[model samples]
Target: MSEIHGSYDMGPSVLSPENVAPKTAEVQDLERILRGEISAVEAYKQVLEKYSTYENANSLRRILVEHEKAVDFWKKQLRSQESFVEESSGPWGTVVETFVGAAKLFGDGPTLRALKEGEEHGLNEYQDLIENGNVNFESESFIKTICLDQQRLHIATLDSLIMMNKV
Candidate 1:
């Protein structure tokens, strides 16, 4: 765990009963982020099914792959820590699907808008963890650098795609 924490006491209090019941706050937080990434993957799949032949399918697929990579990265890390990763995206995934599903009825532009909003929500989640999460040094660095960067790129990509889709 020292490698994960990057040389430290590993934040002893992070494992206190109050801080850890089913799991430590840090692990719980990571799982929550993981679920969001999973939800992103699902939502993209839904959109891709509806937009399979649309001009932006390639862009959506690229973003979907990025989301999938995040999910895989977190799943492996959590498994290595002996933590259980949620098999489903959980409730949050359902909510994302609902929104995107409805948007699909409105048209491709609306669907892209919904996805952009979802990506923004995901970006906000990463920012919140950076500012408020009790994760170790390495985890924080990972979120601040890689995670946040990816979120920004995803959102920007969605924004560009949305504009292209607009008349």
Candidate 2:
């Protein structure tokens, strides 16, 4: 099994994948952004591996790069600042895990549709985060921008699913 700390030496911890659902609205917003970062990163990797065309591959790569960078930026912000409350249940985490399971029982189109739906849910969660003062103004702005970018990518993925699967 893979290690949680991004290393092989650490034994795989049985910790439940984090849910970014915060109790407070502000913290909830940050959690949604955090969860998006996680989901986009994973989807980026999956798309990169699953597709072959230069255009499609590069599209996924760009999305992955941006989201990965955002993840790094948020991690840094979390380290430097205070006031954000972390969450235990996040839409991104749950959706991605659910997608993994769905892949087994559903066609690629269905799976992609499910992921797109999850992405939409995640976008809504982030919206709630922003409207609720779940984060500072600057942090909120930054995460909101990232969430928007993820939305565009999610839309693209949805289109790709329809094109590929006739869905």
Candidate 3:
């Protein structure tokens, strides 16, 4: 059997195991980020609906637009790489959403705080990926952009919370 790249079997082979390994790893990392973005979208939507009458409702809505953009970007990246895009937030995100729903019972302030914490968590996750070189070079730019956006959202959420307190 002929070999390519000194590792791939080129005879009667339908798939290259060596090539598939790295690609699968990259896809899995990107999918994790995509899932986080999906969770962010859901969390922001819940906050918007629960606090529709709050003074900063419009601000929260604007932040949701950012999360939506990230979601779209990650989904596109996954599709381009021929990866299966995850549509749900998974178990942990479900628990967080449940807590967010409960937080709404207290007040908009608490809900906003919870969202701020979530954004901070996302920012750290992205930073970890970038710092640890978990993302491939081609995907680094997208990950960095998402990290910056998460930072902005976290700061905005904090600002909104502070402003709400002053009211």
Candidate 4:
């Protein structure tokens, strides 16, 4: 009901940095996962472009869309609480970009494997977030359902794609 700035203020406040809710480990982890989703979208786009002619392009694109949705969900949460959304994917994103870029040289097999690896990393991250008992993030159901489902689906899809390519 309130304006974005009226309800949430991410700017430097009169209070010290430590007092900010956004600095909490849970928010930090949420932002990290959000950034990872952004990075996943980027990687998917790159791999999709490289393999546009492949028969399973739509499946790959579906996974990309799922990642994008996760990014949007996190961004909305940050907007409500943290009052800021990350534009860049941050440190791990840089690593993903570099890994995918290099994998392109080796062709479809490596690229698909690279994408699967990324999904595995994401799955592990989500699990870690849920396992952190110190912070019982309310959206754990969403993490388990949508987030984990998409990651596992991507992994399985990529696995099938990888095996298909081998033939």
Ranking by TM-score: 4, 1, 3, 2
Q: After superposing candidate 3, which stretches have Cα over 4 Å from the reference?
A: 1-23
The per-model lDDT (C-alpha) reads 0.83, 0.60, 0.74, 0.82
Global Cα RMSD, each model: 9.5, 10.6, 7.0, 6.6
Candidate 4, which segments miss by more than 4 Å at Cα? 1-22, 134-138
- Model 1 segments more than 4 A misplaced: 1-21
The lDDT ranking, best first, is 1, 4, 3, 2
Q: What is the Cα-based lDDT of residue 3 in candidate 4?
A: 54
Q: Taking the tens digit of each residue's C-alpha lDDT, what string does model 3 give over 25-124?
A: 6677787888888898898888777667876677777777888888888878877775656778788679779989997888756776778788888888
TM-score of each: 0.82, 0.61, 0.77, 0.83
- Tens digits of per-residue lDDT for model 2, 25-54: 544445556766777677556544555454
Measured by TM-score, how close is model 4 to the native structure?
Answer: 0.83
Mind giving the per-residue lDDT tens digits that candidate 4 earns over 56-163? 888888898899988888877766664456777989888999999999989889988999999999999998988984234556878877888888888999999899
- Which numbered prediction scores highest in TM-score against the true structure? 4
The per-candidate count of clashes, in order, stands at 0, 8, 0, 0
| Residue 4, candidate 2: alpha-carbon lDDT | 75
Selected candidate, larger lDDT, 1 vs 4:
1
Q: What residue pairs are clashing in model 4? A: none
Task: Write model 1 residue lDDT over 84-167, tens digit each, in one string.
Answer: 667689999999999999999998788989998988998898898888856777778877878889888888888887778841
> How many residue pairs in model 1 have overlapping backbones?
0
